[model samples]
Target: MVKKKFRYDVGILFISAVVLFVTGLGISQGTPQKKNPPFEIDRFIPVETCADCHSEIYEQWENSMHSLSHTDPIYNRVAKFLRQGLIDNDEIEEAESCVKCHTPVGFVSGFPTRLSDDLTKTPEIATRGIQCDYCHSATSVTKMYNNGLVLKPGHGEDDPGIKRGPRDDAQPDFHDAQYSKLHTESGICGTCHNVKHVVFGTDLETTYTEWENSPYNSPDPEKRVTCQGCHMYQRPGIPATGSTERPKNPGAATDYSDERPHIYTHYFVGANVAVPAMFGDEEKSNMARERLKNAATIDVDIDPADKKQIHVTVSNTGAGHSIPTGLGNLRQVWVEIIARDRGGKTTYEKGVLDAGSELPEDAWMFRTVLGDGKGNPVINIAKAREVLSDTRIKAGEQMRQTFDMGFVPRKGTTITARLLYRGAPQKLLKQIPGEPIEPQPVVEMAKAVRTF
Candidate 1:
């Protein structure tokens, strides 16, 4: 009995040691973190260092989405959720992958991104997502999607860091600067803009793919308008493609530098307002609102043959990419149509947001629907098994919807159609954990009215 008891105790000790060994190796994050970090974290210069000389450009990028990529509250929660969920699914490596794009410095420098690691203590450089140093340090892009950026970080803090950009004549007093043709091309943006799920092989994002196939991607170099052309430049309205006239933004590239014809604006504005507003960036939120108001056009008319039929045409005339591009499953675009009788009484309405900002079932939504493998609709990107449907208006395309008015228009009847945009669906917002976010404000992109 004593011998048997001793053997049991020995077996328990062996199991405990094995657990401790695995834990020490950082096996919890699937692949062990780099045993020897590639470079010290200080090798990646903080954005504030560049801000000292390039204050204007730095302010433009301060509240921009790229700068908020890693620290966005919803993004952090979702990423953590993905990591937690994947651990149960036995696919922990996918959880560790966000660092590639969201926290490039941490990923390149191997500064532990494990869930168990305390992110609250993250270095300031790591918190400034997609900042100046990181982009300028990009050497090349070998792959097309899922953060394929190849980074060659600067030597060290004491050394003059090697930085690259589109300018050939750049001469900075503090660091080594070289001209890189890749910085001027769209392929570099494609590296991170296009995303395919690592394990599932699902096409998660198609921002690059949409632009690649659009007419704006012309064969002639002078006629091609890359993602940077529109997104990185300031314009109240868009489609600043090579096909259209884009006003040059005159500004000094840096202190004591020549005033340039155009230095690309760095707000990187698209259709995001709520996220920026949540973080108290009203300027960015207003810029987003202005951009959305100018993004599309609409026309409404009663059919000539069928007096009761109303035709509403919506055109993606202003954007170089598809309307509602990026994170297809979350972004929502739809048309709200309304008809009023002569007495100012509401006769018919569709796509109206309820008190809670929820869209009615009949709303004509322009979005992608992803499904779990078994044909069940899934909201979380991690659970997306397949794309069930995509109803977004393609770049440079038009969509016309005809509605049966159910009655003839009276002499004073009015018909209206408004194209609207929301950052994310209401249902998905409710599902996100932690403090509930305020409902995203609805922005009317375009509207047309006809009175008989």
Candidate 2:
């Protein structure tokens, strides 16, 4: 009995030591891992650094979706919810998931080293702020979706010498000029443009694929343009070098070359005018409004008889990529058609946000919703279980919807079609139903075609 008791004690001691050893290794493995100084908060290169030289590209990038990716109010609120949800459940590690995209530098630099603080608060790291350096420095992308990124900071085949981009006339003050082929490729955008559910493996978004497959991507001469073509191209009036904003273009091979040609415009403009409008940048907001107007065209077909079918055809005529490019699950783009009769009677209406959760009976919606773990519908991206459905129009893709109604417009009746870009669907706002949503500006893509 004495011998047996002694052996049992020895065994217990051995097991405890083994467990301690394993736990130590696990803790060490999870320790902060910092790779390069560029990622370091204090060592980060600011947007101002790049703007000083590449003003056009810098300005364009500053106003782009990437710049606003983190600072965006909607994104901020969603991220807060995600972080809180994980923390409330003691899933602290999982909370870092959003930092990978919204605050990439902080994640890479070990600032979030732990979840006790707002990672974006690091001044230098904040300055980097998803600027040109971070993107231009990306080595490769490991996965096509869900921010599956593989970054290598040091110089490589794709490095723009010391400074990278596509410009025969580009001059560099800080580093050697090397044009990275990757910069011009669609893959650059795919790093974030495509998204997938981490748990379900369901494709949440695929803007890259949509553009690659669409007729709009048929190359410039083919009249198919790229995302860069529309977003980066400069307006004829927005001069590259002027007394207002001096041109950053330094290298010159020809006299006919426009200053805008050398430097990509930094307007980084898009359809999300609401946020900027909220921030009181009415000028930029108006510009964004116009950009949306240029994004698509709508055609209406209606018969002036009772119980007529109204067909609305929407085409992605301007967007270089899909009309709704990123975060397809949250982006909603559709047409609101209204038909009136000579007596000032309402004949048909669609795409209006109804008080009920259901969409208008006759309106076709270009949006998606997901099912939660319980198989119930969910529009909050933070709570997505699986994608229920998606029908966002792709670039160069055309969709026609028919609405059958009892009332028919008489001669001289007015018909109006308004194209809209809602950042998030109503279902998403269901969480806080009473709160006001940042209203997405509606653009009049087309006017009346005259009644039959």
Candidate 3:
């Protein structure tokens, strides 16, 4: 009887151990697994796949900076310059930062330092720049800055790929769609728009931060405006593949049940006209020019005390961020004042580009100056360690410049002031290979003429 009892006790103990082991295994399977550094891009779908349904959006994106981020000749030149510098200094890790945003698919796929200037030689998805699948597959954002995003890879071509968008009730036959509030907010934009120096941790680009602190980010819905609201203008039309006049919906179902007020157009317009012009996208280039023209206002005020003294006020009237926000070190924005006598003879001129497309030494530029560790001005963005000074006009802010007409002007002297913007400094462009030394387009953001 004692032997029988011992066997029964052992059997019960074995059963308990088996149950505990199964429960632990279940818990482990239920827990989320962490993805390590250098994400996989095997699941990324090319932009062409999205074009099958989102034809209009794909066309608009084809001309956008997002598409040219990796393929832009000027950007490629700069990236190559920076990468060679890093390689010379034996900083391979530092070099990877450039491709992290520009060619994200390549960076995350473990070839961060292999960005080729030739787009044809680059990986298919990398050449696509920021494609649709990579964005829609983002499961979460780790932070509001510095490209801190978490993407989930799809298993197969037929898989919906965890599509996340702004709409909740979207039912599509081709893919799974779910609502993601983050998609509608500026935080998602902040992921790639904000940049930090890989070596010094200096805040390189703060376009997102500037908007976050501006009046455009107000809590009041009536007064608030998002980055998408301006860049992606909304109009009544179809959002997906169908007749251009079809109802706004995700799919092409005959039973048109849902209709939205407006479908956001994906022009992604900004101040960068150089790249689009280089790519022969005249419409996008014109749109960029118009956007710049509407971004600021110029006002000329004569000093009450001294008639010879004139104050030119430039205000950031339209942009939600600073006038020359991102890459301010490279971007050039300034007020060009041309005062002339009745005879049309140039009297006093500032901010005039010389024959080499270079601004005069005395030009008052609205941009940020960065300094290296040795306190010397650095044109290479990767070498900048700190901001020396920032003179760009913030959103809803105005900057005034006083000009002393050294000599008394004629009674009817006409003063014409134009707020000019350029994508790159002439000096920088000259250093880039294959780029013509011709004058970069000087977009006139605002202009004012007054007779004093």
lDDT to native, each model: 0.76, 0.56, 0.71
Against the true structure, candidate 2 has what lDDT? 0.56
Better of 1 and 3 by TM-score: 1
lDDT of 1 by residue, 287-361 (tens): 888777767889999988888999888888777788888888788899999989999998888899888789998
lDDT of 1 at 134: 83
Q: How far is 102's C-alpha from truth in model 1 (Å)?
A: 1.9
Best by TM-score: 1
TM-score of each: 0.87, 0.74, 0.84
Q: How far is candidate 3 from the true structure (C-alpha RMSD, Å)?
A: 12.9
Whole-model lDDT, model 3: 0.71
Model 2, total clashes: 6
Query: Between candidates 1 and 3, which one is better according to lDDT?
Result: 1
Q: In angstroms, give how far residue 155 of model 2 lies from its true place.
A: 12
Deviation of model 1 at 274, angstroms: 1.4
Stretches off by above 4 angstroms in model 3 are 1-34, 37-40, 85-93, 113-121, 234-258, 434-437
Model 3: per-residue lDDT, tens digit, 1-452? 43663564366347435533543344322112234355555666777777777776788788688888887777777776666645433133344456668877766666543444344556677777776777777766654545666877564366656678877778866777788876887767777887766445556788988998899877677677778767656222211111112233243221343445655566667778888888899878888777777788999877778888999998887888998988888899988999999989999888888887899978878888888767888877667778888889999998888999787778788999999999888787677667465567888888999987
What's the true lDDT of residue 81 in model 3? 65
